[model samples]
Target: MIGSRVKYRHLHTFVEVARLKSVVKAADSLNISQPAVTKTIRELEELLGVALFERDGRGIRITRPGDVFLRHAAASLTALRQGVDSVSQELLDNVPPVRIGALPTVSTRIMPRAMTLFLEERTASRIKIVTGENAVLLEQLRVGELDLVVGRLAAPEKMAGFSFEHLYSEQVLFTVRAGHPLLGGGSVFAGLAAYPVLMPTRGSIIRPVVEQFLIANGVAALPTQVETVSDAFGRAFVRQSDAIWIISSGVVAGDIAAGMLASLPIDTSETKGPVGLTLRTDAPPSLPLSILIQTIRQAAGEVLPV
Candidate 1:
């Protein structure tokens, strides 16, 4: 039997506090006083008859029960927001835009073509794409901030509440400016360490693979290294210097085709990873989301190799 005392405010407050692990931070985020936030949490705990958090001098930690409840609370909030959006769209006779989260590789290479083809076929459709690291995007999808995330499959632990559909695989590449001094070098092992190396940041799905590749090739570290996942910065940096960039091939496919950049002779097929769509398991696809997925499938078929 459920109690009538629980309210949305309680769930919302609980989620904020759980996310930040601090009542003060949660209160600031909610734009409410600390006492109000604390009161709401207490009320929620009383209604449920379970303690959600364990407080300490440093901060609070979610109890085991709280961890489980947090999932349900977050899901409930997501469902409520989805319902509100659906009602608003129906009342306005407008389709709510599909919100997509993407990683840099997909956003730069695949999405432009996909978006163009989708809009051309469905003239009234609207899409909003946001890009970030794999973990951030997955969390946004879990909380219903995004309809789906299109990117490389994350590790199993990072994919708890989502389902992934594989679209294609992409290989990482070692690339440099056109006519870079190391271009025709017989063995890149010696020359690679001599130039600045640009590679993905630690959290990116491709980072470990790149590190492993370097280790296998007996290169302990680059003389100079810069870590990033920005396609724009990578392109400009490589074009003007002898720096070698370790990145997914799709990120610079256009530049390679245009003769502005060149990939080294190294074969990175071993570092290939799956690029795919991730959706919340609890949320079934809405009509707009389905349409976008279908369009993306078509676009991938045309642009990506099987």
Candidate 2:
């Protein structure tokens, strides 16, 4: 029986081979020789007293034992990497700051209120907020630069390393300056076609859905007065022109309340969508991060107002 003298490098090498399914490929990835990779796999199998890989005429295949071992290997690697990151953060006096990335809409609205509540409770911790489009934010979350994100979940399916917690739904609303011809007495959709519309940039998640809805309803080729992604610009453009601006209700609540903009009377039943929180699927969130997520969830519920 091999005693408690096993090293992590041997297990890591085995995992690399199992993942790549070829000694040459794994060796190249690890910057080691194919023979060295083969030896490590053999050594790992011997230590475990099980065949990790079955090599046939076609190629190598992972056995049942190999699958089980690979699961543990991957988990162990993740834990080791996390430990290293924790230690590095400590050495740098980083204090395990919770980095949050959010969509600009949320960044300006619910995020600030939630963060205020979070900071009140966690006075000792550090918090960082980054704002961008959903795609950019998700990419940051995947790369570990963000502990969590509060934004629309992107995709055909959720990415492997992330989990989403649905916070609330944002209803799309079209607004125009007060007393504008298309205001239609504070209706959401009324008079939408009387004036050219200003929309978010074409690549925004809501753009396609909004366009499709308009086209399906026989409102195709609605004149687009302009397109801009900047929230400030959107609000300013609406304030200065009769151009309509579509925005998430949660994002423009303050402007609506202040009487700077009025929602047109159009039925937005077709434009509602999920707005939620995303975090790494496999990692246990840090204590501070957990608290922040809850606070954001609560704030989102309140700010969206059904």
Candidate topping lDDT: 1
**Taking the tens digit of each residue's C-alpha lDDT, what string does model 2 give over 5-93?**
55787878888888888888899999989888888888888888999999867679899999998898888889999999999778657
Tens-place lDDT per residue, model 1, 1-306, is: 454677999999999999999999999999999999989998888888899999777888999999999999999999999999999778656766789999988888778888877777654657889998787888888888999999999899888888999999999999999998878778887788789999888977888888998899898888789988788898999999999999999888989999999999887789998999999988999877887788788778889885
lDDT of each: 0.88, 0.79
How many steric overlaps are in each model, in order?
A: 0, 9
Question: What's the residue-level lDDT of 109 in candidate 2?
Answer: 80
Give me the overall lDDT of model 1: 0.88
What TM-score does candidate 2 get on C-alpha atoms? 0.64
Lowest summed lDDT across 10 adjacent residues in model 1 is found at: 117-126
Q: What is the C-alpha RMSD of each candidate to the true structure, in Å?
A: 20.4, 19.3
Where does model 1 exceed 4 Å of error?
A: 1-96, 121-125
